[model samples]
Target: MSGDIQPDSHANGHLNGSSERPAPLTVAGVAQRLGVAASTLRTWDRRYGLGPSAHVAGSHRKYSPDDVARLERMRELTLQGVAPADAARAAVAFDPAHPEASPAPSQLVRERAPVERLLVDPLSLAAAAVEPDPRRVKRMVEQEVEDRGVVRAWTGVAGPALEMLAQREKTDLPGVEPESVLRAAFLTAVRDAAVRDDAAHRRADLVLLCADESQRLQAHVVGGGLAEVGVQARVLRAEVVQDPSQVLDVVDRRRAGVLAVFGAVPGAEDLVTAASERGDVAIFLVGDAAPSLWLPHVHRVRTLSAAVEEMAAAISTHV
Candidate 1:
């Protein structure tokens, strides 16, 4: 770990030349050193009042040495299994002069929420979603997809975070802004990735459609992952086609051999039944909220990776 910047003296034995205080670190700089996201720091500051002491009217908040020390202590406590709220309380009460006086009892208790066990730091992406700059959030989503690919990134990070955000929205009454921003950014990123230049040459035999508008994002993510590995999955939103026959018409016209339906749309069973009549089309039920009713040759997949794999295999075989 890097040492915090001090204002006591210069590196040399001589006294410092100026009387001005050392400039406090920005959120990004402090976040980099602390091994956490800048948004996470902002969230801590907003929720726990552990913000920087050096504040300007028009500028970003800056973290002084003491502020950074408190944050470091907060991180340490949280890592030792303390709840964030309790950890923040302990961190705020921490005294720099007395190192041994840190909150050992809270750390020893190892208090954690049930949600934390389900997903590792699910609030990170949620925090990023509420950032002042939507562009930064979008860029972060694109970068995560670029680095981790659509399937893993969505499953491991975006999916869990969005789920947690939804739960928070229901219980905490946090407005829909955070979840909406994150979903839009994620959908935009994945849809951009799904676009292929050689679309005319490659046959898009896999058709993905969600009956519910809420499930469209997952469908797009699955389609995007399939596209990454040479399968150009055709994604259609529920709003575009109200009637099951409309999707069936596209499937029949395009000679699409694989059809994946997502979410609990009203006419999904009817659509699946019609699609099943055409023995050539392989049907797949994708996402958690997909219809439970199953027919012969119908496959069910609850995850993005699973949906992509099944659909890709079906497409490859059909082509």
Candidate 2:
């Protein structure tokens, strides 16, 4: 490798096997460094075939700087709605003068006030849960919602980022209970995003107010993903009254296109019953719902990946 360094650059910036101090970047490393879910890398590897031949440690995965750069480029492409496989190919062939490319990361951040303050700043949400860092989480949620919309912020940013914190804290890592703060921040973002100008050509999007305990958090995530693509999502995270008849009023008042509940939560039967009464709007009871209680209008998403995929497809189909 060349020992020369560019102006204002360190030789240390070069990523490869040349350094003895720093270990080679693994799939997990890149995932963490890039602030994306590990599952996203697996999707790129399996679906787009964007990785090494195999890891030196058999099942382990390693990525060179080129690989990480390609992944970031691919993210820019796919988030713009290009398919993963196509994005992978495009990343390999990106040009400095590429006309189709929108703003660079710097410009995108500078131009969008929200994305700059929340979405781009990596530790904004993480800081919020630490009490000492309340604004961090709130800012992150606000940025994501403002940039991608409420549902998108809820799912893509707040949900996963909170889960990451919970996992970190659960394993006896540093930090306090971030769940409440994160939820509050997400709710704030959702409310603020709801009144934005809607496109005249956009279809009538539904707001799903999740009111079941088990479904509340999952529903919030779903709501966020929905918001990313311009769908409306409201989350009433718990307070689904036992009176199924009265529940109809909440759904109707919100003009909900879909009523979603967390099937894993207790009193899920009541949730299903409430949805059963709503004949017109689609009812989606997420999480593990009993097959016996299944209704035709109800849609169940088993995992985060499944939910993201479903939301993307549904948005494309409808909105």
Highest TM-score among the candidates is held by which one?
A: 1
Cα shift from native, residue 266, model 1 (Å): 1.2
- The lDDT of model 1 is 0.70
Task: List where candidate 1 sits over 4 angstroms from the true fold.
Answer: 1-121, 169-176, 196-201, 239-241
lDDT of each candidate versus the true structure:
0.70, 0.55
Candidate 1, residue 163: CA error in Å?
2.3
- Model 2 poorest 10 in a row by lDDT: 6-15
- Residue pairs with backbone atoms closer than 3 Å in model 1 (clashes): none
Q: How close is candidate 1 to the true structure, as a TM-score?
A: 0.56
In model 1, the worst 10-residue window by lDDT is 8-17
Clashing pairs in 2: 124-136, 128-137, 151-223, 151-224, 151-225, 151-227, 152-224, 152-228, 215-262
Off by more than 4 A, model 2: 1-128, 144-157, 167-178, 197-205, 251-255, 270-274, 277-279, 289-292, 303-319
